[model samples]
Structures are given as C-alpha cells and as structure tokens.
Target chain A: MKRNKAVIAGIGQTEFSKNSGRSELQLSCEAIKLALDDAGLAPSDVDGFSTFTIDNNEDVDIIRSMGIETLRFSSRTPHGGGGSMATIAHGMAAVESGLCNTFVCLRAMNERSEARFGIAHMAPNSNNKGSGSGFLEWSMPFGAATPAAWTGIQAQRYMARYGLTNADFAPISVLQRKNAATNPLAWYYQKPITIEDHQSSRWIVEPVFRLLDCCQESDGGVALVITTEERARDLRQKPALIAHATQSIPFDTETVTNFYHKDLTVFDSGVQCAKEL
Target chain B: MTTNVKATIPANVPATMPRPQPLPGRDSAFFWDGAARGELMGQRCAACKLFRHPPRPMCPNCQSVEREEVRLSGRGTIHAFIHPVHPMIPMFDYPLTCVLVDLEEGIRIFSNLYECEKEDVRIGMPVEVFFVPTAGDKQVPVFRPARDAKAGSKGARS
Candidate 1:
C-alpha cells in the first residue's frame, strides 16, 4: 500500500547500565523527553505510542508524566526480542494509516535489576502469561530454561552444517565489543574483549555460545519518533526515512523454542523478513 | 492451606526437587501418555500421511483436520545438539547434552542425549530414543549413540 511513506524524525536513548536504580516509568519519561527534544517537538505533538510489550513501562503512564494532551493510537509488539523490527513496522503503519501524526516507538528495561531473562525467570513457577507457556513447557522440565539453551539448539545445528567452530563466533563478539567500546553511552564503553578472552570465558551453552557472545542485560530506554515523510522533512534534523519494514513468521516457527523445524541451521524467516525490508 | 496431588508428579522425581511438568489440556495428551509408557507417538494426517510432532488440531498440509496417531521409529541422526556448560536450571547436570534428533520419520524431536562425551557428539551422528521415567508414570525421551552408527559399529544408516 505504498509503504515507506513515513520517516523517523528522532531517536533517543539513555545510558545503558546493569542497574538504573530508577523506576522503568522514570526511564521511559526521560527517553521520551529526549526524543521530543530531538524532533524539535513537544510532548504535546505526540499523538500515538508504540513500544515493547515485554517492557515494564506502559505508554499511558509515560504519557501521564509527559502531559501528552491526547493519544490517538497506541500499540506494543507482543513477542519479546523478535518484535523489535515489528515495533517500527507498526509505528510506520500508524503514520501511513493517518491514525496518528507522531508515533513514538520505545523499548525500555532494567533487564538485570528489574527482570533478568535468563537468570530470574524459572517459569511455570513464575507465570503463565509469558509466551514460554507454549513449547517451553516441554523443554523446561528437562532444564532447557534459558534463551541461550533454546538458541543453542539452532546455533549448534548451524555450526554443524557449516563446520564452523566456537572460535568462528569469537570474531563477532570481538567486533561488537570494539564498536561498543567506542560508544560512550554503551554499558561496555571503552571496554573491548579479545578472541582469547572470548574463548576463555565460561560457556553459557556449548557448541556455539560463550559468555561474550551474549549481549549485556541492562537497564535503559531507547525511543524513536516517526511521522509522515512530508511532515518529517519540516523537522529539525534529517529524517531516517522508512524505506522498508517487515515481519515474517515462517512454517514451523515457534517464538524461541522453535525446535521442530526441519532446517534449524538457517534463519529462513529472518532472511525473508530482511528481504521484505 | 497445604494439600496433596501426587499424581501430577512423576514417580522418579525427588520430592524435594521441583520438576517441570508439561502444561496440559492440549490436543496432545496421548503424546505424554505414550511418554509415560516409554513409547514415541506423533500425529499423522489421515489424508496425506504427513507426520507432526507435539500434535496439533489441524493439518498444515492439505488443510485437513482429520488425523490419526502413529508410533515413530525413534531412530534418527543428530541434526544438532548442545552441551550447556553452566546448567542454568538445577534439574539438569552441568555440561548437559541436549539434542535435536532429526527422526527417520521426517519429523524432529527435542530431547537429551546421553552415553557419550561432548567431543564424541557430532551432527549426523546416529541416535535412538530411550525413556527416562519421571514422577507419576511420566517419562521423557532421551537419545543415546546408536549401536550401528558405523558399518560394523551398529550406528549405520542407508
């Protein structure tokens, strides 16, 4: 439907930390303030909200603090990690559909302090509202509890099919650490790891992942403001045009415990989603 | 206000330890029931003979709702497997080997693999299922290296 008609007018992020100490709502307000300032707009200009459902912060709560006059639309991407791009997709769709003039997409969390993904959640015992109630019900009883254990299934298959060794994944960690080390806002800023360090680090799951391969679980907020491309051009800075946005769920796809697929090695769904983007 | 319902717990589970029980009330009660009996079961499309694991109500192929139960051969190659070094959950031992066995029936199953060192495990390595009986007559499928994996080795496949 002639998509890409919307463009992101601003982006805002808070310093990443293992513990922000502040409440998630406070973090959400701070990021939203920065986003509005970056876009050369006030909170009053924000007419819609899009965010991570997994985020502890709520849009209405954030809006209450910002004193946003009205919200014409709001949404959250339901599935956790896989929904990042989809969050942007829904934001752009809001702009395209004329549902709202300014749509803000946000993801904020104190993952380590507030709710640790791998460490804290010992599910079925925790709650059933989480998507884990699906396939995880089968695996968790057997100790396949964390995301790494789940992804290890696919990662192992990928390494096997390609003859890739654990060392092969080290370069990726090294490169990311190098990049993060330079970004002052990153939790690992100015701290880089070597392949040696990555290799020696304890394994979270074997055959593919080590401690370094995993991302930092931190407390932070990141937000983007999207508006129609025509309106975006009049803003304070160059707009990041929504050239493309797409989400794909292929056959035999389960959110994370997607063990049943015939070809677990390749992210066929991700490849297709990227193609659409 | 404590009460008792021990039938939900597998027999072999230690009383002090909390075990992961499948969240029931789905279309696949038979699959778990079969696991309790040490058998592997899958759903077969009555129309196309296509097999599905963790049974579902509808057939993905041919859009047929009609289905029947079939017991699988429980033999497959190691499509991929992992050994978690840290063992996040207490139910498993550290250096745990979890496998995604690509069943000969063209379906896949997730389970633990045993009877081998971490280095000895390989993709495409042959394996067969065995049952680990748990509390209340429930059992979980686990794989071990196939005896005929090599020609004279017993793990051989055509």
Candidate 2:
C-alpha cells in the first residue's frame, strides 16, 4: 500500500522514570492531552488510538476518562522496542485507510517501578508453558538466563568476528546519551558520560557488555497525533512527515531467537525493513 | 554403550528422569555437537569461502547448502563489550560483561567470560575458548584471557 500520505501533527511525552506516580490510564490521558494541546485540538477531535500489546493502558478507559468522542479505531503492535516505529506506521495506515481521520499513537509504561522487564528470570509460571518458555528452559539452567545474557551471545559472536571491542559499542550508548542529554523530557537529561566512564562502569555479562551500555527502563508515556497531509498543514505544530513505514520478519525467525542466522551482528529483519522502506 | 546406562537411570528415579530430547535442528546441530565436544564450531561455505557462526545449513553468502563444519581456533580479540548496571534476568546482583570476539577463522561468537575479574576485562584483550556444561550434557563455549594480560595493557584497552 502507498503510505506516504500521512503526517504527524504533534508529539508529547511524560517524564521517564522508575515510577510514574499515576495509573496507566492517567499517564495515557496526560500524554494524549499534551499531544492534542500541541496539535491545538481537544479530546473530542481524536477518533483513534494505537499502542503496544505490552502496554497496560486500555483505549476504552482512555476514551471514557478523556471524554473523547467518536472513537473509530484502536489497535496494538507487538515486539518490544521494534514496535516503536511500527506504532507510528499503524497510525499512518489508520489515517490512510479512512479508518480514523485523526489518530494518536502512544507508548506508555511503568517499566521500572512495577515490573522491571530487565529481570532475567521469573519462576516457572502457567503463562510460560510450551513454546513460550522454550528458550528460557534451554539457557536458564546454565545461568545464561537474562536478556543481556541472551543478547550477549550475539554480541560475543560479533566481537569474535569483527575485531570489535567494548569501545565500539560505546558509540551506541554515547549517541543515545547524547540525544537524551539534550532532550528535556529524557530521564537522564543533561547527564552525559565520557568514554572513561563507560570503561570504568561495572559489568553485567562479562566480556560482552557493561552497565553503562544498556538503555534505561523508563516509566514514561510518549504520544503522537497523526492526520492527513492536508489536515496536518492546517495543524498548529510543524508536521513530521511519515516518509515510509513497514514491518518485516525474516525466515526461521523466532521472537528474540534468530541464532540460526549466518550473521548475528546484522539483524536481517531490520535490514529488510530498511530496504523495503 | 552410554545410551544403555542412561536409559536405565530413568527407571531408578522416575520423578527426576530426564526426557530423551531430540537433537537440535540441522542449522544448530553442529553448534550443539561442538558444544558437546568442547569445541567452538562455525560454518564455512565452499561456494564463497566465507566463515559464519550460530551454524546454519546454507551459506549466507551464496545460499549454497554445500558447507563444512570447521573448528575455530578459539582465539579471538574482544571487538566490543558492555557492562549492564540494571541486572538482566537469571544473572542478578553480579556485574555482567558482554564481549564481542573476532575469531581467527573470520567468524564471531558471543559468550560470557568467566574466571576473570570484571574490571580486568579490556576491550581488545586476546582471549581463548572455555566451555561450561549445561543440562542434558551440553557444553556452552565461553572465552577468557589467553595469558597474564592486564586490563589496561595496550592491546587490552580500546
């Protein structure tokens, strides 16, 4: 489908943190309200919503509390951080397909205070049965049980093949931190680290990564308002045009386990998405 | 011979009897076999003459099923590393290091470094393979310093 027709009219976010000090519904409303304000619109103008499946906030709850009228569309995307851009893509699709004229895509979570997703292992539970807990069952018994540990396999393989060092990965953290420092809304606002600091930081999964290299588990909500290019031009904020959007999955792919791929360093799905876009 | 003994052990401890699991699929069977033998194995494509890891059947370069299982030298230089402050699952309370190693055979392997201090690990340190066994008699290959290499040495630091 041709998808270059929609644009983001406004963007809003709540403070990122270990705790949000509010319910998921409240955080969602706050972000939606800010986004509507940024677009110079009211709650009554928003007719659609899109977010992540991991998100606890409900669209019905948001609509009821925010007094939003004429709810036409609402959906959710999966796949953790990979869903960030996918959420925007969904909003664009909704606008282009005439499912909703004015849509808001949001990602809000109390990832830190309530449930720290970074935790490596959860006790064997009913939800973890069958294929869901397969990888866990394989690695947990050997102490390679955390996300860092799982990802460390890829990192180690990449290093072994590329002659890369911890210093090479410093750039990723450095870039993110650099962007976060200037971002007033970021939890680590104005907090920048030096290469020396990264080197000196404590290790999390030896030889593969350190503490400073990881992204923070933030408790924040970010929302974006999308509309047709025509309406976007009439909106108050400068529209961030949606140039292109697509999602991809590679062959023999599993959630977080693509070990069979020839090159662990390069994510084929990401490469495919970039190429398709 | 060993299979017969293993088959009989289950009857003595029915509750603790381990199920006979199938071997990993074609793509990962080599890796699992290498781990069993305490060897780090990677795939080298005959078509393109390039080495790859997390072993797969077809060559990623040429999509050729004609490949060979080659044992890596197990010697590599640390390419990249990370220290995660917030503990990731399974391994908690201990500082973890994620090391990227450039294998001599032109493939990269990702694994943990053990039997060394976290502060002592440097970005470019030369390391060799070590194996840690897992359940079902599987061995997980890891790496560590090859010699008395200090963390701040010229070759060790980024």
lDDT of 2 by residue, A1-277 (tens): 5553898998888988778898777788889899999998889999988887667788888889999986888887765567666888888888988888899998877878875656754454412432342444334433354567667766766786788777888878887888889988888899988888888888776666888877788888889999988787778988888887888867644455444455678878889998988
Candidate 1, residues A18-68, lDDT tens digits: the string is 889898888888888888889998999999998755667766788888999
Per-model TM-score, in order, reads: 0.89, 0.66
What digit string (tens of lDDT, one per residue) describes model 2 on residues B20-103? 222455566787688678887887898898887655677866899988788877887776555444443322223444465777
Interface RMSD of each: 2.1, 6.8
Residue-level error in angstroms, candidate 2, position A83: 1.1
Clashing residue pairs in all predictions, respectively, total: 15, 47
For candidate 2, the lDDT comes to 0.69
Q: What are the runs in model 2 whose C-alpha is more than 4 Å off?
A: A1-4, A126-137, B1-158
Docking quality tier of model 2: incorrect
Q: TM-score: which candidate is best?
A: 1
